[model samples]
Target chain A: MKLKCIVIDDDIHAINGIKSYLNTLSNISLYKAYTDPLQALTDITGGANVDVIFMDVDMPMISGIELSKAIRHKTSKLIFTTSHSKYAYEAFEMNASAYLLKPYTFARFAETLNRLFPQSPSLPNISIQQEEDYFFVRNKNEKNSLIKVRYSDIVAVESLQNYVRIYTTNETIVTYIALSEIKIILQDYPNFAQAHRSFIIAKNHIEKVEGNTLKMVNNLTVNVGNSYREGIQEYIKEKTIRTSRS
Target chain B: MINIKKSPPFIRIQNWLAYKKFHIIIWLVFMLYESVIVGLFSGQFGNLINYILFYSLNISMFYVHTHIILESGLKRKNQIWWKLPVLLSLELLVYLMIYIGFDYLITDILKYFRPRKIGMTMQYILGPVYRAIYFMFFSTGYYFLLKFLSERKKTEELEHQRLNNMIQIARSENAFLKAQIQPHLLFNTLDFIYQNARDHSPIAAETILSLSEMMRYSVDSNKDKDFISLGEEINQVENLVNLHQLRKHHQLQIRFWYDDDIKKVEIIPLILITLVENIFKHGNLLSQSHPAEIKLYLQNNDLIIETSNQIAKVKEKPGFNSGIKNITKRLAYAYGDQSTFESGTTEDNYYKVRVTIKVKHTID
Candidate 1:
């Protein structure tokens, strides 16, 4: 059964943004969206059984923390989506399931959902745009000749000073292109993600995620930066097998 | 000047009234003391009319001797030695004639005994002569005292004004120094860390290097130079973006798009950096669907730096981009009719900034 969700944010833009995020997920569906906190409070308290509630911390009428307290039992899980990191402690005290900081990526949103619902099925192949599965880059070893690099074959891309090393499943390509420029090229691809300050890993090639380190397919280990730990953990959990007994 | 004008008018008027009262009371007490002291010595009391009549003539002579005659005569620098003594002797002679006639009128005509009879006798003339000289001596001292007091006040005012001007000059000089000291210290500390971290922690070293470059650019640009190569500002903007991306682990959804050829165009500095800073401050760059954009290009030889991002839901302090207002004024001063700066919230709730500088056609 798809988990029912409600988004309550004072900004219409934020509510619509949450709506778009909900549209991309397969296991969670939006029941309603609210721009008015007072109306949400009055309606939710009247006894609507919601599976999840995504609320903004800062609202005009009442804070999401205060509103969450009143309707704590109405939903099984509550998540706070705000730009303020200061309210993380308050969210903890309110027993929120998760706190998604505003300006959070779709990957972050999907990751938060997967953590709260570990038993939920994996997300479908959601692509916002249809682009080529591979692109050509001038490999330095080939003497300025362009070689095709598939998106799926990339295990990780590591920055070594001024050059970038692309670790593919078949061959390693060292390009003269800076990692910053390579990042812009891979920005549209969901599989390639920045895991550390100098490393971008393909989410599908991970063999194991032990602590802050990820073991890739080729016995290649990638250390996760502290700030990027959440994104890495979410991807691992999304693929983790959990039974009803657990 | 400031100190002199600080006192209220009402307080000054009260001081003037107090000064006038002090002078009147001193004169009245002196006249009574003279009458009482003389009567005690002689063992006989004089009538009130006689005391009033004599003291009035003496007071009149006291003021006239200094106020009118001495004031004008002493003001003459070259002839004062002869002019002052001659004027004083004439005043005394006129005083003695009046004293003799007044004594005759009182003692002979009215049968009143004179204090000192001035009937062509040496003893009587000597008493009146001594009285006139006593007042004249005091009036001359009073005139010199007034001159000394006024001179001190003039010098005091000049000193105060000079000190105020010096303080103003010091503040203006320190304003330039204040801008450099903090940034100079900050970049030096960053450079120290950059040296130590280069071997072991390349990421930390890279971050520090970018931070130092931006700091150095900011300090150098604040020198108020009229024009600078756009290449330097573009390099600093890239450094700022790289620094932020490092902090965010390369997750910030910001695009810095420009061609290498466009970087050669010369333009003013700080305008592009400030607008980019506002984007990081107030833009929501997390959405892959709505990425924040910073586009720089040349169209029709007009250099345009355009930036736009979706407005964040978080409420910051209002009028946050007041730096944009400063850019408007700076562009107006430098380019006059050749520049146009427009920045505001778009209808789609995106904060956008576009600065276009029209360049004249020139041979490459």
Candidate 2:
């Protein structure tokens, strides 16, 4: 389904900037852009069935926070595009799907979109083959070479656009395979778990769990998404040390 | 003008005494002298009671006239001139009547104890009335003298405060004047560049726009306000990061993360920006192995900010770490002992700054 998105920002320039960026994405369409928060609030409440919203935090009459509260139930996903880091906590409180700081690059914007619509149409050509405790992924650099990656040697899988960077014990390989495809191939492996929207990690490779971040054996720190946190916790629950006072 | 209510009782009493000490000392000395004279002249201990009654009445009348009557008159000094003589005459007549009534009552009571030597005559009544008039004149003079002296002291205090305020303003203005020129020039130049580059290069225009935004924030945010929304400061930090990234051609790896609910938090402006700027100024951000990281999160009620960067092998320019010093000073001024700021080079040679501010009361 084409994602119906709206942009609400006080700055016309910012709205235009976001519009230009939205033009490049094929799966998402900009439904409307509002410079006035009250008008946006009105339209949102007036039965505009929006799937996603890109909102600015600092608005004149009604803040993005208040507007989000007003239309939160109507929208499927809420993304906050702000210039300040201070609003991250507030955006989180509002259960924002993604937070993009101002002056963000196209790559960062694409990353947020991927997280919101992970199963979009562009991700169709991701194919993987598994054989006896190992997987073969088509390497993008070497057009026809299929790289062999052992399940035991895999440390993490980082998603970059339509490609996945497979970090192994011996070498790092960039393969032209989607993270979702890799997930399907490794679904039956009890040790491999999705740590973030853009990351898949081996449960045993995690050296330490520090707050929302997972420190891996090779010093790769992967963030744990709010949605995927439960699965990671449950995967490590049995292995966690417990002590009781007698 | 003075906040008497906020002062403790002891201090209030001391202030009262400081203003009225002269009048009180004079009254006490006169009372003592009068008692001695009356005892010596009368040569009879029985007359001491009359003197005591007369002195007590006189002192009480002086207090009532000076503190109540004169105080009110001085408070409305502009209007009191027209009513002064009439008010004084009415007060004197009341005093005379009170004295006469008290003298008759005291004499009648004394007759029960001793023989009455003094008789109820016109001379006797007139003499006390005359003495009451004289005491009124004396007390009124003392009251005016106190008013004049206190008024002078008040003016001197006001002048002192005004001078102190002027000096403070001058110091700030001096600092403002020193810092204003470069940013104004730089902002105009950036605007010119933005206008020129808009049609040719959108990226250059965007970079200039971001630079001007950062410059505007740095100039305007700290003008009169000590605190700004955390969101505003973060925006400037983003601009700083963006500008640096563009300068380095996207070679540097930088990551900024914060807790999701921290937008409503207030902090002294430019604090986080200063820390981030320090990284660009002194740290080796070009090394992708150790990407510069900035993280802001909440632990309980405290807002914690941590920034880490790898120490550069080659120093571009010598820095005394004045940015960190300024941040510490500002935090100390705003939060006092409620905030903690610590910065040092870690064991891995990474320069790190950790700031934890107690925000339980500040956050809504």
Candidate 3:
């Protein structure tokens, strides 16, 4: 399902900025944009229910904090779009889905959407494949030698420009292969999933998942990229042993 | 924080006996000399009970004479000269009466010893008077010592307070000078310029944005905040790098490497930023193969921030204003012996600066 969102910012340019970013994301669409916060507050409090409400912190008549307090239950997610990180705590207090810092790229916008509503429709084509259980890659660290990498042994793969560093439980092996090429090679295994633009993690190796960071069993942290949050979120939701409650 | 020097003569007079081991020992030694040593030479062994009873009366008179009579008489400074003599006379008369009463009870009433002459004669009064004067003289000296000690302590406390006041004045003066210009106005004005130039001159606007970010960090982070997560400083460092790259037409070769765990490690502000700025100022940034590298990592319990760069054309001590000296001083002030800062050139012409701050976080 496409996420219907509302934008309430005093600055017209800021609203337009959000508008341009929303245009790039296929899964999220802006239903309304309010340059006047008072009108937005009246409309939202009256009876407007949307998937997300993108609010600004510093406004003229009323702040995003005060407005969000009045109509928090109207939206499924409240993503605070602000110029400063000072109001991050306030946004968190209001149970905001994500804190989207201003001057953000299109990828950051998509990341927030994918993280908040992972099951939303129109995400970029992400097809999972399966083939082999193991492969050998040229280890750049050990004199460009071929190293046996069992699918079960892989913890995380990090993209470093043209090289991808594969971290396992015992040691790290740097290979002179692009991350995309490694993604294709590891696609045969169902456990390997891309968490960020530069990171592909083994789902079974995730010791803990806190916010947008994954704690791997090998004692490494991987930051989930904005555009790649859906796959990781889906995997986390499936693996999580939840109590029988909504 | 406020170190006040206090030497309370009677540390606590309410429970004075507990702390007065010196007073108790001196009294014990003097009593031993009078009763045991002098009694041995005289060869007239008195009854043990008589000695004990009479000595207890003398000890009581000693404290009552100084602490009570002397303290009350000298409390009024203007009348102290005459009041002290009157109090001393009253005290002497009271002591002689109590001594006679005790002697009568021990010798005549209880029949512990044979009765002496019961008349108030010169010999009877003279012995008691002499003993009273001796103890009164010693108590007066002890009283004066307490007053002297307390006064000296007051003087020291006043001196310490004055020194602290001078330091406070100096600090506020520095603060007043630094805070003359408001950060809010500076940021808003830059924001205004950035807004005006964005459409026509995008490059200038981008530079302004980066400059404003660094300015905000320096202005805001330095004020009230002593330590911040590496994440905040990393953002500003990236801004600085972007600004330099734009100025040099993207030819500045620099790579900033830091793990997510390293980002959460708290450190004193401006150290990382200053080191980065120093690299840009003195290091050769155009070499593709020898690109400048800044790495932040946690090696066990130590947080290591290392920067290595090639030497520039004219590296005259590689600094931005006060340079690494200010960083060293700040780190010393905050982390003290738990931090180490080293900066110098390697033999192969590469300048490297490594700073390690010892923190309790051991996130590998």
- The best candidate in terms of lDDT: 3
Tens-digit per-residue lDDT, A205-235, candidate 3: 9998889778889767676765677888998
Deviation from native of the Cα of residue A63 in model 2, angstroms? 24
Q: What would the per-residue lDDT of candidate 1 be over residues A59-173, giving only the tens digit for each residue?
A: 8879777898998899999988765432233535555888865444454677788888899953744343338888787776666489888889999887643457788888777
True contacts kept of each: 0.00, 0.00, 0.00
Candidate 2, A1-246: lDDT as tens digits = 778989998877777777766776677789999999999888889876788899987688987788888888878989887655332335355467778655555546777888887888323232445448776776655653887789999999876434567878776676645577688788889899998766899999999989889988878787786668899988778899778866
Off by over 4 Å in 1: A1-246, B1-111, B115-134, B153-187, B199-201, B218-229, B259-269, B299-301, B315-317, B344-349, B359-364
lDDT digits (tens) for residues B302-322 of candidate 3: 999999999887847734548
lDDT of 2 at B143: 77
The deviation in Å at residue B68 for candidate 1 is 6.6
DockQ value of candidate 1: 0.01
Q: Candidate 1 — which pairs collide? A: none
TM-score of chain A of each: 0.55, 0.49, 0.51
* CAPRI class of candidate 3: incorrect
Candidate 3 chain A lowest-lDDT run of ten: A121-130
How many collisions between residues are there in candidate 3? Answer: 3
**Rounded to one decimal, what is candidate 3's iRMSD?**
9.8
Q: Is the docking of candidate 1 incorrect, acceptable, medium or high quality?
A: incorrect
User: Which residues of candidate 3, in runs, are more than 4 Å off?
Assistant: A83-92, A98-111, A119-246, B1-205, B219-222, B315-322, B362-364
